[model samples]
Target: MKREMEDVVIVGAGIAGLATAVALKRVGVRALVLERSQGIRTTGAALTLFPNAWLALDALGVSHKLTRSYDPLVKGSVTNINTGDVQQVLFSEQAIRPVHRKALLEALAEELPTDTIRFSSKLAAIESQEQGGGASIAVVHLEDGTAIKSKVLIGCDGVHSVVARWLGLAEPVHSGRSAVRSLAVFPQGHRLKHEIQMFVDQQGKRAAFIPLNDREFYWFLTCKEENMTGEPEQIQREVLEKYAEFPSIYLDVVRHADLSTISWAPLMYRHPWRIIFGNLNKGNITVAGDAMHPMTPELG
Candidate 1:
């Protein structure tokens, strides 16, 4: 018996991988998106798709729709926690749409073709070759002893991409800081202004809040990179204890949140165009998104 070949095999079904699938399919090419995770699960806090990111999605032909504005009571301001001096402020009032991470992923997935994504296809290595007919060929090996051959290979496996490793790219560099993020509901009566607020300390710690929907606000606290191995209860208590002296509005959001919904990660980044594999003359293998250049999640 003989096996079949695919046009392109994508590693990672994240925002970048899924988006690429849509783009390739629209151009009449078949794409297979492989995800290491067992399912399409999104962890971490909510996100604000700023104007730039929205434009990118729009160019991809997907619209960014929000059920409702998150921060109607927002009073935009950035303050220095140590000196109490204002660094930036927008006195003018306006609503900024915020969306849940799950909602955003679902929406993006909806735009892609079905049967193109395969979960649990953790990549192990890639081999390149020249072909006599049609597009050049590259082979991908998965951790579970499954091997897929494709005419083209794209690595969208994120910052810790195995494709990058197979290409001998260096590991992502730590940015010296870590971020703790979450989304919590602040009761209707406790609705905050629609302005984003940020507090930065001289010790390299920071906290921020942005309302995504009427009832809930997205909040985050960043501190020096440290190990997080404590129980959820302990993690929750430590988060609250860190900002015990914050204003009532801050506490109110935390009051409605538990450690289960909290998320944290150390910031990291990778160089652009770190490595290029596959048939360069034929353009069979390529990389995209964080696999190409991983960076901190700042404004977006």
Candidate 2:
């Protein structure tokens, strides 16, 4: 029997891949998403969907579903926890909403068709056609030895995308800093007024805390790259040690944290204006999001 072909084969099931699949489906295209992981894992601390992304989500018809479950950050003010000084207030006047990374992924995943995603399908290689004038095709070889052919192969795989490497794209550069993030449920009777605080000390290290709906507050700490590779327990200890001089409530928050919630990653990014991947001869192979340009969380 002849091998079957997919209209589109997207690698990775992160934000970019899922959103692209949903968009393609909306436009009447059938796309298959291949994810290396078994399922969506809520690992990141929190994510701020900038106004543009917010609008994009609205256009995609998922905005209401997301907003309904997440608390819009009606108020946000940056503070210098070191000296107890206020730096600049985005004030509740301007609307900025923060959502848990996991929640957003869950919602996006729910919007997608149940049969569209193939998990544990790591891309091992991609064979692209370079000759002839006919429509180009891409063959994606999965780790499990299953080969999938498609008219278009989109690499939505994250920083270490195999498709990117297969296409000769350079590796991602580290930003020389590492960040640790954690989310915790506020203790009973401890009412946390909704506020997002950023504490910058004299040493240049920084920490942030934001209150989400349901009495959950997200906290993060950024430090030199050297401090981030250790175990999570050590990282949590280092966080406590570094922020020891802050207000009692700040330290108290850490003390009461659910240590298991902490996660860390060394910041990495690709040049924004640069097109790491060459032009697709037949518009059959491309990349999006982190695969194209992974960057720090500058809220851009």
| Number of the predicted model whose lDDT against the real structure is largest | 2
- Measured over all alpha carbons after superposition, the RMSD of each candidate to the real structure, in angstroms, is 3.5, 2.6
Choose the strongest candidate by TM-score.
2
Q: Candidate 1 overall Cα lDDT vs. reference?
A: 0.71
Sliding window of 10 residues with minimal summed lDDT for model 2: 273-282
TM-score of each: 0.85, 0.90
Backbone clash total for model 2 is 1
Model 2 lDDT tens row, 1-300: 235589899998888998999899889998999998899866776776667778888878888877777666655556676677876665443246778887777777888789899898788888986647765679888878888889889999988877767766667788887788887676563587666777777665777777776567788777667555577778778778867877676676776666777888898876543443443233578788888777877623
How well is each residue in 1-300 modelled by candidate 1, as lDDT tens digits? Answer: 234488889999888888888778778887889898987767676776655666666776664344332333334677786687876664323333466777766666777778888898788888887676654688888888887889888999888877766666667788777777777765654455666778777877778777775677778877788655477566566767876765556666766764566877787876444434322122577778877677776522
Error of 2 at 257 (Å): 2.7
